[model samples]
Target: MMSKSTPLAALAFALSATTALAGDPVTYQLDWLPGGDKAPIYVCVDQGFCADAGLDVTIASGRGSSDAISRLAAGSSDIGMADIGALMAAKAQEGVGVTSVLSVFNKGPHAFYTVKDSGFDSVADVKGKKIATSPFTSSNVYLPLVLQDVGLTEADLELTKADAGALGPMLMTGQVDGIVAWMTDLSRYTGQGKDAGKEIIALPWSAAGLELYSAALNANDAFLAERPEVAARFVAAFKKSIEFCQTNPEEAAQSVVNMVPELEHGDVLGSLNDMLGLVFNDVTEEDGLGVFEPGRLAATWTRVAAAQGLDESAHGAEDFVTRSFQPGGEG
Candidate 1:
């Protein structure tokens, strides 16, 4: 007694389901507010790379890695971009079911910036100087290690907690002797200094022996387990976007500005070029972009374990990272 229309309705429903399944929905979270440093990701979305890969992508800005990781664990986002060190800390403390698939910034960007007139020629000179830093920044998290390496201690400097945005203006106005932030911020701060006719000097934490991995692409474990092909497509699309950014710097910056029109185009371009060195290096030159070298990752884990007070054997390097998704991504 079934009506003939029943079969037609069932066929229409099946076709709609197939269309929905064709493009998996993905929500991506960022480690911090949108900026030129995040151009590759914006490029991927604006250029329809993710859509072409059969992903319906939604991008969200993060306060920091802690916030991003928490969101991913809570199922708020399927994937995230965050600091690898922050990811390590989360995995060590809470055993969050999120792991990074691609390492974007091989070189850490933690550093201190001071006007040349501050006479802070090296990390040694930072002692007794007033420093402004946001507790959220990766620079502050590794400040102890950098201090230890430079033969100083937190007690040696006068630290002031401030908003990340306020730190730059504070430094430019001589409100603080130095500002602690990432090297990507260095160019922007330097540009701020130039506007005021003051030269800014960068004393990198790397110089103080606090090298570690920075930003990366991370996914919720369940998402990877259930829809790995979708995740792999995302990785592949992102890889292409990073390559685009490397070759077409101005266009990449413009793509980001296209998404975030509030940002100054020139500043975005300048900052994008400034941070390029951190993203592309010998490791990237040998193994393709977004691929991490085993040795370097091991070294980074040592720093992460020490920073988080986790035992090395308990949290070996492999426990937190994977290369299976990278496939032929190696250069």
Candidate 2:
């Protein structure tokens, strides 16, 4: 029967259906396997920040920064968290469709690790010494620039390319004098040292005047262009999640563990604490979270372009990033 309440019920149903379809769905790709480094993304999901922002975000684990960027460029992911420097290098090449939306790490984590008793006083000590590194590591892509920064050349060191899993064991067994790795991996080698009764020493390139930006939040061009508002909402939620992680790292680490149940609880917490220090610093303190300094970004682009032999015109840092999506206005 044609009743008035029937029409009202149908109208309400239609509205609910429309609302349900309105939330944007996005795949948030991580640069590597779930760990402390990825706590903020987990926090955003666990705390309902992404849902509150009208986003249906699905988190995906990644192989590495290069692999993450490749997937994003191939249009498999809407957004990605990865090594911004590696992304810059990829954007320099043809057929990539990704851009930076926010900066996650203000400083690069690239460093060389050696045992304290190994007698490496500084980066110079790496000269004429065998240094192990995985070919897939982002440290390999920037090794030339790092060596240059220390006034040394590749010829100065005996380099060995090995699997990441083999690096710590090889170093511990004295197969290599030192290993090139990200600073966050210190906890790993530290644990190994504890098992072997040795002390690990880190020589971060930033301390040696080769400062570069590391992991960043990125979005593919099509999604960023087709749905600007969705991107902004995601950014706001991410910023809130980052703040939560900074304030309550232990809880945030627990959330990450809940997502990646295979991860060790203490290891995840340690890595989360180390990553947080890189996430918040003098620049973030002044500009707010997820903000990047234009000057620093520009300088970083110059160095990266030179290192990768990319055309400056094609790899303009300005085009690779947009500030309108940050928490406040431009950072």
Candidate 3:
């Protein structure tokens, strides 16, 4: 006769069986490297949110919004984050097989970083100053529109493109009066400025009338069509993760550090705190979280069309979004 199993062996077998029947496997793609700005996905996995929603999620690193969108369009990832503006541009140009499901950042992340002593307190003050930016940033495309709103143009300022890593240093050393970067990096840049004995100020283009959506959760068409239930569950869980992050920011930051050990805890926490404003702010308060109001969506497409020189009438903004997968959506 077989001997009775020990308590430990019995518990192990039960846990294994539970995991085996836990959930369907889903792949998540990131628009950029692992950081506090990308904390929600990490929180979902590390905090059992995905598992609770019957999803076994695997995260894939992405180089940028374009890269992430491409991966989703190719069916390599079920859902992930990307810039909604980039999605609009790609859909207008190529008609990619992906659609944004949830708006993560309701407002644009584009901003100008300057040292306080540089006398550049707002976008209007940079007309005659020297500016440095990363050549690859999408912000460069909208710079002219923002400048136009401020009654200036690119010709009014001296612009230089440099590596993203060098932007903070260049500004602190007075090599450039300001640098263009995302609001997500405000904490890191401010810390660097403190190290250099300078005070950093961020001039958000949104305040200067550059209004539009930024990052959002997007899904592959095939994934949504084949397993609509799974998509709905993931979106619901993802929404819960964002709410959790807002209530427990330190824990959310720790979730990223838990998944990516190379990141420092304090740095992750600081960046996560800075990013919360982008996720939950006046826009969120007005329109509710994750809902893409029709007026704002159209405005986003309008800005994108102008920036990329695409025909505004060629495609409607709704073409790039599939709202049925939202938490209380039709799906």
Candidate 4:
């Protein structure tokens, strides 16, 4: 028998099916393992920002910026976070098919961490001191430029490469006068220093004239060409996620922990709080969130070229980035 309620039920089922199929699938690649620095993407998924934007996002972990870029270049990831400097270098060297769409960390994160009372008050104070760094960190390439900025050179200090996990222990035990690390590790190193009965001090390269962009949102060229609307929606949603993290840090931290249950909530919160400064600061205040200011973009390419020994004239800064995906942009 045909009943009136059967038609209503069929209509409701059709609407539900339509709503379920509305979300576009997206693969998000990470430049590094899941952590507080990588919270915005997690927030986007966990806090419904991606869902609200009609995206079904899946995050893929990466070993580093280069790996993340490689995935994007190969079209394995639709969008991801990576160091824009790495992208600039890659574009000049190989013409990788990835374009940075938005700035994440507008300032460089390179810094020197020293135990307080070590007489290393500033970048200049590291002269003739022993510095330990990870062999594979991109910071190594920029070390020469940072040293030159402080009126010093590689010859002025003794440099040693060590495993990344050992850097803090080396500094606490006085094995090295300082360790070359990112500002994102400030809290971790500070806690290590306290346990060793010492205080930690960070000398950021940005404070000493390393005016350049760092981490940024990058998208695959093919993805942007084929699904322009999806790319734009993802970028807008990502910007919203960043804003949400800035306002509700604890909630943001929980979002990451919720997705990556192996990560402790406290550690994620601390790392996220430590990373906020790198994301939102003087540069971000001048240029609104997610913008790649032309002057800073040029400055970033200059620094990258100098660090990687690439010819500056090979490509313009615009070659590595596309602004059309941003809110109010041509897309």
Q: Write the per-residue lDDT of candidate 1 for residues 95-193, one digit (tens) a residue.
A: 999998998888888888998966888888999999999966767767888898978999999999998779989998999899898788767888888
Give the per-residue lDDT digits (tens) of candidate 4, residues 101-195.
98899888999999777789999898999999999998998999988998999999999999999999999999999999998888889889889
Clashing pairs in 3: none
Question: How many clashing pairs in candidate 1?
Answer: 1
State the TM-score for model 4. 0.94
Q: Which stretches of candidate 3 lie over 4 Å from their true place?
A: 1-20
Q: What TM-score does each of the candidates earn?
A: 0.90, 0.91, 0.94, 0.94
Clashing pairs in 1: 288-331
lDDT tens digits, residues 134-169, model 2?
A: 988767767888788778999999999999899999
Every candidate's lDDT: 0.85, 0.84, 0.92, 0.92
Choose 2 or 4, whichever is better by TM-score: 4
Give Cα distance to truth, residue 123, candidate 2, Å: 1.5
Q: Supply the TM-score for candidate 3.
A: 0.94
Kindly give the number of clashing pairs for every candidate: 1, 0, 0, 0
Error of 1 at 158 (Å): 1.9
